[model samples]
Target: MLQLNGCAAGSSSLRLAKDIAENNRGARVLVACVELTIVAFRGPEEDYLHTLVGQASFGDGAGAVIVGADAGVHYPAERPLFEMVSASQTVVPGTDHVLTMRITEAGLDGHILRRELVPVAAENVERCLSDAFGQLGVGVEWNDLFWTVHPGLRAILDHIDKALRLEPGKLAASRTVLREYGNMLGATIIFVLDEQRRRMEEDGEGGEWGVMMGFGPGFTIETMVLHATSNLRKK
Candidate 1:
C-alpha cells in the first residue's frame, strides 16, 4: 500500500494512481486518504498557539477515489468525473518552517508559522502555476480555470485570490469544504474535489479546464491539471 502524509498526500496519490493506471493496462488503483489529527493532539503545551491552531483546524477524515484508464471498457457502470491531465510537485525555498509536523517522544508535534504561510504561498504560486502550464507547452490564464486549492487557512486562500486575480467564486468549493469539515489533512482535497463536482453538475459554475492544488509541510505544493468530462455535468 502506498502511503503519504500531510496535505499534499491526496494530490500525490492522484499523480501516482494516474501513472500506475496508464502504465499497466486494465489496472485499477484505489487511492485512499485518511487523517486523524486527534492522534497528534497534545495537552497543555508551551506552544499554546500551535496546540490551539491544531485543535481548531485539524479534524479526522477519510476519502477515496478509484483511478483507471479506459473507463468505459474496464468499468462500464462507473462514470468518470475529472480527467487528470498532468501533475507537478514543487517545494518553496527556505520556508520549510512555515508548516511542519513531526513524531516525537511526546507523540506528535508541529508548528505553523501563520504569518509566513500566506505571504510565501502568494509570492510563489503564480510562478509555480506558470511553470507547470509552461511545461505543457500552453499558456493558461488563472481566471479561466476552475480551482480546487487546499484550504490550509482562510488567509492563504485570500492571499492566493488576490495574487492570482481570480474571479469571484472560483474557490468556493475549497472554502465550503473548509467551513464544513475543517482541514482533513490530505483527505481535504478529496472533499474539495467532490464539492467542485457538485457545483459543476448542479450549477454549471466552472469551465472545462481546472487546477487542483494541495499544500503541506515543507511548504510543499502539488498541482494537477484536470479536464472535466461529461460525467462532471448533467445532460
Candidate 2:
C-alpha cells in the first residue's frame, strides 16, 4: 500500500512526508517542490519578494506521491480516471514578477489580481495545448470529455474559456476549486483532477477524458491529458 501527501511547505507537507517516509522506507517515494513567483503586497521593499521575482521569479508549493510495489494496499483494478497521455511545459522569458505570493506572520498573501493578465494568458494557452497535443499526435475537439484548466483567478478562467472557445460549463470544475481552495499553486490542478475522479466515483460513471494545466513563474505553463476508465469507478 502506498500513501501520498499533497501538502505545501510549513503547512502539512513536512509532517506527512516524515510519517510516510519513516513507515514506508522501501517504497518508491517521490517529493516535488513547486515554487511560484509571488508579488508581495508590502510596500515593494521586501528582499525576499525581490529575490523570488529576480532570482527564482516564481511562486512555490510542494506535493509528494508514493507508489508501493510490494505493499498489500489494494488500489481497485478499475480503469484509471485518466491515463496521463503526455505533458508539455513552456517558459516565456522576461516576464518575471507577473504573479506572486508571499509568506508573513499573518499568513500567505498576494496581489488582488488584475484583469489584464487574462489577455496575456489567452495568447499563450493555445501554444501550450498545441505543443502538448502535437507530441501525442492528437487534436483537440469539442467532443473531448473535460477541460481541467488551472483557475488562477476568476478573470483568468474567463479569459481561458473565451480563448479556447470552450462550452458554457467546460470550466465549472476549475471554478469550483478556485472558489473553495484559492490558488494552491502547482497543487491546484491536481486538486481539480482528484475532484473530477471523486465525482465520477460517486456517480458510478467512467470512460471520461480530461485535460489538466498549470501556470507558474517564467510565465510558464504545463499541460497534460488524461483518459478515464469506467472500471475504476468506486463501488
Candidate 3:
C-alpha cells in the first residue's frame, strides 16, 4: 500500500513516478489514470465551449502502488483488507480533452460532466472492465468487497453506474467520497481506499476486498483490485 497527493495541476503522472522512486524505492509500482471525455454537449453553446476550454488545459496527475518482495510491517489483530490481485488500464484515442480540470483565477475548477461522456464511456467501459478482470484471471462476480472508483462528478458516477450496471450500494463509497471531497485527482482513489480501510475497522471486518479506479487525461482509465489487511492502523 502507498499514499499520494495530486494537488498540483498537470503534474500528477510525474509526481507519482517521483514519489514511487523516492519512497517505494525499487519496488514494482502500478500506475493508473482516469480521463474524462464528452458524451454530449448541451445548454448555452458558449457556456459549453467555456467548459470544454477549461477542461482542455487540464494536466495529468499520477498515482502508484508499490508491490514486491517486501513483507513490510503489520498491524496487531487486524486482517489484510484486500490483496491487489490484478491491475489494468485502457486509452480511448481521439477523445482527448473531453474532460479536464484547470487552475483558474478563483482556484482549480473541474469540468467533467459532458453530455458525450455517457455514451463514449459506455462503449469503452466493458472492454476496460474485461481487461481488468481478465488480467487477474478472475471474474467480476468474484469480487466481494467495495469499489473505490474516482467519482469525477455526480453525472460521471451515474454514467459509470449505468455502464457497469452495478447494484444499488455497489458504488456508495465512491459516491460518498466524491460528494464530500470533490475530485482529488490522483489522490482520490487513495482517499477512497483509506475510507474503506476505516469502514472495515469500524465494522471489525477482516479480509476485505476493494477495487480502485480512476480516469484522467489522454482519455485513460486505470483500475486496480486490492485486498486490505485488518491489521492496518487508522492512518
Candidate 4:
C-alpha cells in the first residue's frame, strides 16, 4: 500500500501503476485515491480568508483506475480508454513555500502563494512539456492534442490556456469538474480524466494524443502523455 498525501497523489499513483504493470507481465495494479478535505475544515478565525478560500474550493472525492499491460489478453471484458504513453515530473526551483499543507492542532492548515502560483506554472510548463515530447522523438503542436489539467484554481487553468495558446474547449472537462465538484485535491485529476473521456465519446472531440498535468506542493508538475486507446483499436 503506497500512501501519498498531496495533490499529486493521483498522478503519482498512475505513473507507479504503469511501471509496475510493465515490469510484471501479468499483474494488474489498482490505483485508487480518496480525499476527505471536509474532515480538516476549520471554523472562521484569524486568517479568515485562508479558511474561506479553502472551504470554498476543497471538497471530498474518490476515484480509481485499473492499470495493466496487454489489453484484453487476460480480461477480454476490460476495455481501455486512455493509454499512458509517458510520464515525467519536474519541480520548480526555490518554490518550497508556494503551496504547502501541514497538520495543526486544530486540523489541516495550508498556505498558497496564490498570485505566484499561476505565473510559475505558466512560465515553466512549455519547457517541461517540450522536454517530455522531445524525448519521444516527436514535435507537437499544443492545439493538436487533448489536455487533462488539474484544475486546482481557475486562474491556473486560465493562465495555462493562454500560455499554451490552446484552442477553445480544450479544457472544458477540467472546468466542468471544477464547477461541479470544486477541487478534491489529488482525486480531482482522475475526475478530469473521466470527464474528458465522456466528452470525447459524446462529442467525438479530441485528438488521438493527449496530455495529463497535475500540480501540487513543491510547485511540482506531474505530466503524463496519453494516447486514445480507441484509436489504436480501430487500426
- What overall lDDT goes with each candidate model? 0.85, 0.55, 0.55, 0.86
TM-score of 4: 0.93
lDDT (tens digit, per residue) of candidate 2 on 30-74: 545454424333343453344333323223444444423333334
Candidate 3 accuracy as lDDT: 0.55
Model 1 ranges with Cα > 4 A deviation: 1-4, 45-49, 233-235
Which is the winner by lDDT between candidate 1 and candidate 2? Answer: 1
> Which candidate model has the greater TM-score, 1 or 3?
1
Superposing all C-alpha atoms, what RMSD in Å does each candidate have to the true structure?
1.9, 8.3, 8.1, 2.0
> Distance (Å) between predicted and true CA of 119, model 4?
0.5
Residues 29-115 of candidate 3 have per-residue lDDT tens digits of: 455544232222233354344555544433333333443322344323323345555556566887766655455444444454468
In TM-score terms, candidate 2 sits at 0.62
lDDT of 1 at 65: 93
- Regions more than 4 Å wrong, model 3: 1-69, 73-82, 100-113, 142-145, 204-208, 230-235
TM-score of predicted structure 3:
0.62
User: What lDDT is reached at residue 68 by model 4?
Assistant: 93
